[model samples]
Target chain A: MENNLKKVDIIFEDSDKCAPLKVLEKTLKRTADDIILDLIDSGLKGRGGAGFPTGLKWKFTRNETSDVKYVICNADEGEPGTFKDREILDRVPEKIFTGMAICGYVVGAKEGYIYLRGEYNFLLKGLLKKLSDFNAALKKLNVDFQIYFKSGSGAYVCGEESALFESMEGKRGEPRNKPPYPTVAGYNSKPTVINNVETLVYTTMICHMGPEKFKALGTSDSRGSKVFSVSGDTPIPGIYELELGMPLHDFVNEFGDGDTKAVQVGGASGHCVPRKKFNDTIIGFEGIPTGGSMMIFNSSRSMYNVLHDYLEFFAEESCGQCTPCRVGCQQLLKGIEAVKRGERPPAYLDDLKKLTGTMKIAAKCGLGQSVGNPFNSIIDNFREEIIY
Target chain B: MSTTEALVKELVEKNGRTRNSLMPVLQGIVQQEHFLSEEALICVAKELDLSAADVYGTASFYTFLDTVPRGKNIIRVCKTITCHMKGKDEVIKAISNALKIKVGETTHDNKFTLLSANCLGWCHKGPVMLINDEVFPELTPQKALEIVEEYAKK
Candidate 1:
């Protein structure tokens, strides 16, 4: 079995010379167009599960003609199994701030905000101190951009770009409709560039090491390495900067506890790949793209419990704006419980699967839409486990 | 002005009386008072020039914003999948037994509140608990009890 799993050392490397501020200084010298072009060339996608091309997002936001554009670093790391963003913020916070500043520069915005989740309130004091220093540095550079911290009040939906904007606006963190996307009308109904914390750090890294170096790693779709938050049923459970497009089999061999039966790629909203399908699966944009969450489950763990937990999470976390997600999540949870309780027949699981299918399209935001990914994947892979 | 009114006014002054300042204003009250009282909410609405219903609407949407009374120290145990798998039930049980109260209940002395939270983002170091702004991760039942006892002493 040939292993294509390659571990990269770019993300956590602590060299004082190639610091994030140095990257920002060099990036500031270049035109906005040049920076956007380099980002597009690198083929970097959003690391926050959505996989939208990072360069195109910046380009769109840059093209938008507005007087008061804004830059936001989405530090609301609420995804169940994904803890890499917090680790990034804890370790290389300047890199994130630099990325936001660079984005502000690219998109013609003077103000930037980091929407840190309330759960990570513990990180706030340290982040605020670092942010003040970074803001001072930006002022010394005559950049005119100052980053601010906005804390999310324990809402998972706020991780969604528009919901994050709403949360910042002191409203319910319900996602707004598209067409007026973040690129055009984000915070305060102005053109805004909102990116995940990791995405921002990668932008800083790309500026520092040239786009070609990042382009040299991973597949065509998923270029460069990503910081993965690997946990559950693994001996070495922690953050790993691994090259994307690696086969799940390779990941399992490297990180799994030998008895790994299934792996939850991404978070609870992501897919579940059984051990049998591990060889066929790829962990990248071209395959099962993740937000750097890979939770491995050993054979001893019950698939029913896993699916139940995910359903419960979605049901609780759903913003209740739409019926498909709000009603659908609760029904699915109830339907599974009834089946397990011997009230509903085993075939009733198919009806619940169909409900998730409806939720895929009917639900308003990603929270509702992607619920079926884990629901269907777990049910498909371990049907018997979900039933008696 | 009453203390709550003074607090709300100070928060409004610090954060501004804009609609955008509502969250921070509410958060400030929570930080000082532990939860948003009706008087605090009304005061914030008056200061921010919003209806009480509008203020409550936003506050109720967030899990962290407690509308009801909470203890001096909030003990939020992570009840997400990873935490559950890593013996969060036992940790919760330990805390419940220690505090002599179930989940979502505060101590009789109003010193600590025991509640279950969705996820605290420390999946690798599972069975985590957040005591107010601080976090305790990779917790055993005994470790959890010890931590709670220390808080109780304080």
Candidate 2:
């Protein structure tokens, strides 16, 4: 019964992932470096929008000072059209727990925190039972690890790695300047390793499959399988795992059973590849980020309204600490309004373009840069809709 | 009622008798009692010397802490894009239909409260529902109702 495909459904398929987790209880005696090498070889990237190499991120934490290190699983997955982590937390909480333990063991950090979103408090309602079960598994495995959950205050920016760390410290969730990069200074100024919930949850699978076997599925640029939400106009819109190099035409129609106009890869921060461009686009770096969110829009949808949602999200969620993000987000919205209301001549459109460029270059952190992505992608792909 | 003199005195005493403790005092009371009733808000305002408007603003701005009494079980289905496109609206409807109540409303038994949220940041799991902080994913309408029914029995 399709043995190769891994399924860790707590509520769905009887129990596919339980095998690897059971094997982990017996194996996993090696140090953290072995796990990192296995991760690097497997070609696993962050499931969140960033798409950073999981191995490379772990390497940075490995390189950092040993004393007072931290391992935090960034469960604060607030990106639009991204529900992969919540699924892992809810359905496969044990797998996520195992991955967190492996990370803590690899990084030699005793403490781990799952920085979950506050809206997920209701999700956590039944999870304490699972957590207790996981804790019991940890003692059984003989790993000296302790993990706790810290709920997010529902700030979208807190989804950023640094911001998640700051929020865990009980401050308002806001993105901090990088260069320290959380690998160096994170979680109360300790050397920390933060992985997206999916990234960590997948480690147990890789630990069982081995890296090269895990790498066998996807493209060279983006290895292994990715989970897609595939919402919007799709008859079978739900999560499906596909290889990274899979064709968009096939991917779109795979579950998005409809006449498609465009595919918004990588959720709100990702690009809107027009239907014509679908042939050339793959879900990876050589392609756009699958970011694990594939929202297909048909003719019925308006490009303007879609772009508006992204801009509005940024405007409302900006941390308000930095000028570029705090002010530029509002300006982008105002300019959109100005254009929509016919207040600006077509020539004024040049200013909006230039301002977006300025925000990209001068903004403080990932929030500003990420905010630029949705606007940039819309202007590039949907210029015709935007211009008139 | 949050306004009983016994509870109010305990809350104010716990927060210390300072004007600055107004928000903290109300927040403390809510944490203890699980909902900030109108009487509790008034008690906090009276004890802390802050306007009721100010107290209400602090309470409502953050969505985590509730001001009104919540149902015995709260189902916060993510209305975020990942969830929405995956039939979150339908899921909400299913919950409402089963409970015979609408979103943001409680059942007559006060056993379930249904509400929608932006994103819980776990976009990987579409059509996700959080029942009091523990999320359940990939829900069909029937499965959701069954979960709600279980909670109702509790």
Candidate 3:
């Protein structure tokens, strides 16, 4: 299984050979349907953890009739352990802009926006300069597409597409109801193609190397390699571009500090895979799909503290627009604390688990709904550690 | 015109006086002034044609869009799990001890305000802090103090 762990280089590949502008020009020669079909053939899902089919998302927005449409790059990389998007924005922003331009060409959008999180505001000045150059290049090519930057004030909920739209509209970053999804009514209440920054980069790569090349990498469900932000209890902690569908055991063996106890796949909202399940666990859509957050925990760390930290984070970051999320997060935090303080019996853990169940069903958005993933996995695997 | 009023008017002119311009307008004020004063909020509401409450509502929702008065420089130490794992507490303590201010406190001179923030997305290089827009990662307590001392002189 360790031998199967191969590092891939499609993401940070030198742009001299596969230049983004050249890829855009080559892609524009093809019809929009053809480009979308290539994306569909590539089987590239949204790299932002939701796993939505990227081609289908673009096709939906493209199909919608609208006077005004937008292509948005969701650069709000606020997932607790995820930092690949930041590296992407810092190193190769041209590729991201070009990807958005291609999306604009395909989706009939004249304007695009990158809703970057406020913490990464340091990158804004450099990004703006690069964007202006990209815009100039677009004008020279007679492409009527332009990209702009929108800074999100420190709100994690704004990472949600609809909440991002709300933030862009100068409102509170709250997730709107679905059905009128981003494709149908998004930023400024028009048809929009909103993609993760990494997802857009993959679209550009798919155009450069063709779908067959990308489709050859990972399993059918999760196609192409992904940029993983590896941190915590690891000897070499940093970003890695690895082929998907490898067993979790291989990842632990490669990145672990040798005394690894558990790995928190994805961010705080993602699942906690105990060491025993490493052989069975797959780091792809077929098993525990992550948005590229692989936080390895060694035996030295306490699962109790990790879970407590996560609950506290969720409690603070919840938008408070939905009661289920707002109150549920608070209660979970309290519930765990009470158990640890001996205010509640060990049996009380089961009741709190039920509360997370309610949160799973009742919470309005992914932030609240996914809290159960970490809560259940941690409590189920390390119940004694959480108790006393 | 008051500085706040002038700033608000200037931001509206730059970003456009629309409902969508509310965020950038507020962010502009915070960038310059460090926090949204009541006067700044009112000016923004008046310039953007909204109620003061409406403006404040949006501003207060974001952690970075500080409503209370902040110092000339804001020091946000990343307190998320990874940073916590990599000795953010020691870093925070060092900053607090050096500045004679705890987390969420402003210096008497209004030169610096120390606050612990959530993830700044530098997990690999943990124990990170942002002094305003500039991010400093992979800090020991000594390095954290040195960085703060350098900012204190400014």
TM agreement with the true structure for every prediction: 0.99, 0.77, 0.99
Give the Cα lDDT of each candidate: 0.93, 0.72, 0.94
CAPRI grade of model 3? high
Compute the TM-score of each model's chain A versus the native chain A and list the values.
Answer: 0.99, 0.93, 0.99
Q: Write the per-residue lDDT of candidate 1 for residues A1-388, one digit (tens) a residue.
A: 6778898988777799678888898999999999999999999999998989999999999998888999999999988999998999999899889999999999999999999999999999999999999999999999989999988889999999999999999999999889789998999999999899999988988998889999999998789999999888999999999998999999999999999999999999999999999999999988999999899999999999999999999999999999999999999999999999999999999998899899988888999999899989998989999887
Report how far residue A211 has shifted in candidate 3, in Å: 0.1
Model 2 residue B80 CA deviation (Å) reads 5.3
Question: Which of the numbered candidates is closest to the native, going by highest DockQ?
Answer: 3
Error of 1 at A172 (Å): 0.5
Model 1 regions lying over 4 Å from their true place: none
Measured against the true two-chain complex, the DockQ scores of the candidates, in the order shown, are: 0.89, 0.26, 0.95
Indicate the worst ten consecutive residues by lDDT in candidate 3 chain A.
A1-10
Model 1 compared with the native: what TM-score? Answer: 0.99
Spell out the clash pairs found in candidate 3.
Answer: none
Ranking by lDDT: 3, 1, 2
> Lowest-scoring 10 consecutive residues by lDDT in candidate 2 chain B?
B19-28
